[model samples]
Target: MFTIATWNINSIRLRAGLVTRLLTEEAPDILCLQECKSPVDRMPLQLFADMGYRWAVARGQRGYNGVAILSRLPIEDAGDRDHAALGHARHVAARLPGGVVVHNLYVPAGGDTPDRTVNEKFGQKLDFLTDMRDAFRAEPPRRSILVGDLNIAPREDDVWSHRQLLKVVSHTPVEVAHLSDAMQAGDWVDITRQDIPTGPLFSWWSYRNRDWTLSDRGRRLDHIWASRDIAAAGHASRILRPVRGWDQPSDHVPVLASFDLPV
Candidate 1:
């Protein structure tokens, strides 16, 4: 069996210790991290290498958006999406020894203001989704797993309070529709949704909230999607909530999924 995990570490430099802890505890075959916020050269590659994981490939920006995939097994060709218009560090893909390909993504977070007319960031977010849909329609990967911080809560049950967060940035109708279109274009299946068909499931909590536990205003911004061919093999999917209470936790927690496939 192979396990894959995705976590938005917020900043690899700041969270290196936490990452080391996670690598030792979870021991996933492959770990995809987003929001690394450090250049590849500056990232602690040797640390993960010493922990039995090889730094396969990483796409990063200076003190901002960044992504990396660490693997225990050998990785073949890997690359990032050419979202030239937005030019954001949002995507990366790697091919394993087997036919399986893994995609790591960090979708644009539309600002609090949803009006694209006023918010350029919001417009960029929409355009990014559109580009993704077009790209996936052109070439869809087979036997693949796409995982990351999608930044959009696609379903009503994905948020703690859909009624209250309807106007929120992540759950807005426009963002949801665009995300749905992208999923349809890729013909991707939400593996977690397939397993847990009901109730509010969230992977993100607000650091602004004084009492996040009591307020409980969370959104499911992260996801793991699989191609139809390998969707049935997805099992043991879970969110590591306890990690949120760690010494210095990220607002987002890790989401893990295991498949009965060789690494």
Candidate 2:
């Protein structure tokens, strides 16, 4: 069996300790991290190496965007995505052993406003998804798992207050449609959705809320998706919610998925 975990660490430099803790606790065969917010040189490579993992990173401007994949097995041929016109550091993909490819993504978080015409960030977010759709349509990966902070709650049960958040950026119709377009383009299946096809699943909580547990205005911004060929092999998908309460935790929590693979 092989396990893969994905999280938006917010900032690798600031959350190195938490990352170390996660690595020690979960020991996933592969961990795909997004929103690293540090340059490749600044990342604590030696630390993870000491913990018995090899890592590769594709980075953007420091203090802005970055992504990395850490593996107990070997990883190779890492590359970044060109989001057509948006041009953000939003994606990275690496090939692992056994012909499985992993794509780590940090989809653009549209601005608070729902109206794309008034919110340039919202427009950019849509465009980014469009580009992703086009790219996958051109060249789709086989036996792949795509995981990350997709920044969209594409289901009614994915949020605490779906009715209230309908007009919100992440749950807006435009964003949902774009996300669906990307999924359709790649013919990818949401592994988590396939398993837990029902109510109230969330992976993100607001730091501003004093009583996040009580308010529960959370959203499922993070996800794991698999190509149709390998979708049947996926199991034991979970969200590490307890980590959200960790000291100095990120607003986003880790989502984990496991696969049965030949050794």
Candidate 3:
């Protein structure tokens, strides 16, 4: 029973205590975090180690776009790729003891405008997805799991009001197609959706909403995907929404899954 969790922590240095609480409480064997917003050297690794997460692989930038994987299990740094040539530390991979490669990614949130023509950020987002698809197709993933704040909710049910959000950046048709293409290209299974196949599941809510839970205008922007070969072992998918109510919590909550790795 190997459990892993992913969260868009927003900032690691500021939220180190929150992470510590999660580590001591939920205690997933491994936790992948996104948007660390701290340089690699500055991450609160020692603090996490004190909480029993003694190993980690991370790629980070000064004030934005970073990813890290903290593990109780022994793991090795596998490479970090700067998808879309945006030069952001948005990805990191680690090889677990059983040769299962875990990829932690932070996809770019295309700006408020969905149009690539006017929004360079939006164009970069689309380009990033294309590169991901191409890379996966080039070297198919075997025993792998990819998880992160993908930033796009690819299903109608993934958003609170899909109809209203069709033009919204995260729930737009173009973005959904790109995410689906990437998923199909990698032969990945949506483990979260597979486990809880029917529902309005969400992991992100806007801070704009004063009463986020009451409004419930959320989106399933984060995701956990497993390669088909090891997907059958994936289960126990869940979202830690309550964490959003934590003191100074991130806009995005944690998403978790368990894999029945053979002994």
Candidate 4:
């Protein structure tokens, strides 16, 4: 059994303490991070190593678009694919001892506008997801777990006010359609939703909302997905919503799942 968690740390350097806190407390066997915002050399690997996560694979640039996987169990560095040629360190993959591949990604937020014609970032987001679809179609994923701040809510219940957010960037129909295409191409199962199945689940609460609990306006931007071959192994899915309430917390919270891998 392996417990894995994924979170958009916002900035690993700034929130290293939060990582340590989670390591000391929840102690997931593997932790995938997006938006690390720091180079690999600058990551606190030694610190994480001290807390039992001695292995890691990462891709990063200065102050932007980074992803990493830290593991207490032995892990091998799998390739990093810059999907859509975004030229950003948006993805990194790692292989676990049992050959399960784990992908960590930070998809573009697509700016404020929904129209790709008017917004360059929005265009990039669509292209990135299109590339994801093409890549997965070319080489379908097997025994893989993908997690990240994918930046789209995708489902009606994923956002606080689905009707209100239908025009919003994360919940927009176009964005959701693109994300769904990628999922379909890879034949990935939404493990988190599979276990829970229903309800207003969310992993991201905006910083704009003061007293976020009262407003309860949040989105399920972070996700945990498994290739159909291993989908049955995924269980105990949980969103660490209380982590968002921690002091100096990231706007995003952690999403977790445990896997009972076949021997």
TM-score of each: 0.97, 0.97, 0.99, 0.99
- Per-residue lDDT tens digits of candidate 4, residues 1-263? 99999999999999999999999999999999999999999998899999899999998889988888999999999999989998999999999878999999899999999998899999999999999999999999999999999999988899999889999899999999999999999999999999999999999999999999999999999999999999999999999999999999999999999999942
Q: Which sections of candidate 1 miss by over 4 Å? A: none
Clashes counted in candidate 2 amount to: 0
Please give, for residues 1-263, the per-residue lDDT of candidate 3 as tens digits: 69999999999999998999999889999999999999999999988888788999999999998999999999999998889899999999999988999999999999999999899999999999999999999999999999999999998889999889999999899999999999999999999999999989999999999999899999999999999999999999999999999999999999999999942
The candidates, ranked best first by lDDT, are 3, 4, 1, 2
Candidate 2 Cα deviation (angstroms), residue 178: 0.7
Please report, in order, the local distance difference test score of every candidate based on alpha carbons: 0.88, 0.87, 0.95, 0.94
Cα-based lDDT at residue 206, candidate 3: 99
- What digit string (tens of lDDT, one per residue) describes model 1 on residues 1-263? 79999999999989999999999999998999999998889989889998888756788889899999998888875778856367777788999888799999998898989989999888888988898899889998589999999999989989988888888899999999999998999999998888888888889998998777788788889999999889999999898877878888899999999888776
Model 2 stretches astray by more than 4 angstroms: none
Q: What are the per-residue Cα lDDT tens digits for candidate 2 across 119-226?
A: 888878888899889988998858889999999999999988878888988998888999999999999999998888887899999999987888878999999999
Which model is ahead, 1 or 4, in terms of TM-score? 4
Count steric clashes of candidate 1.
Answer: 0
Q: Model 4 TM-score? A: 0.99
lDDT of 2: 0.87
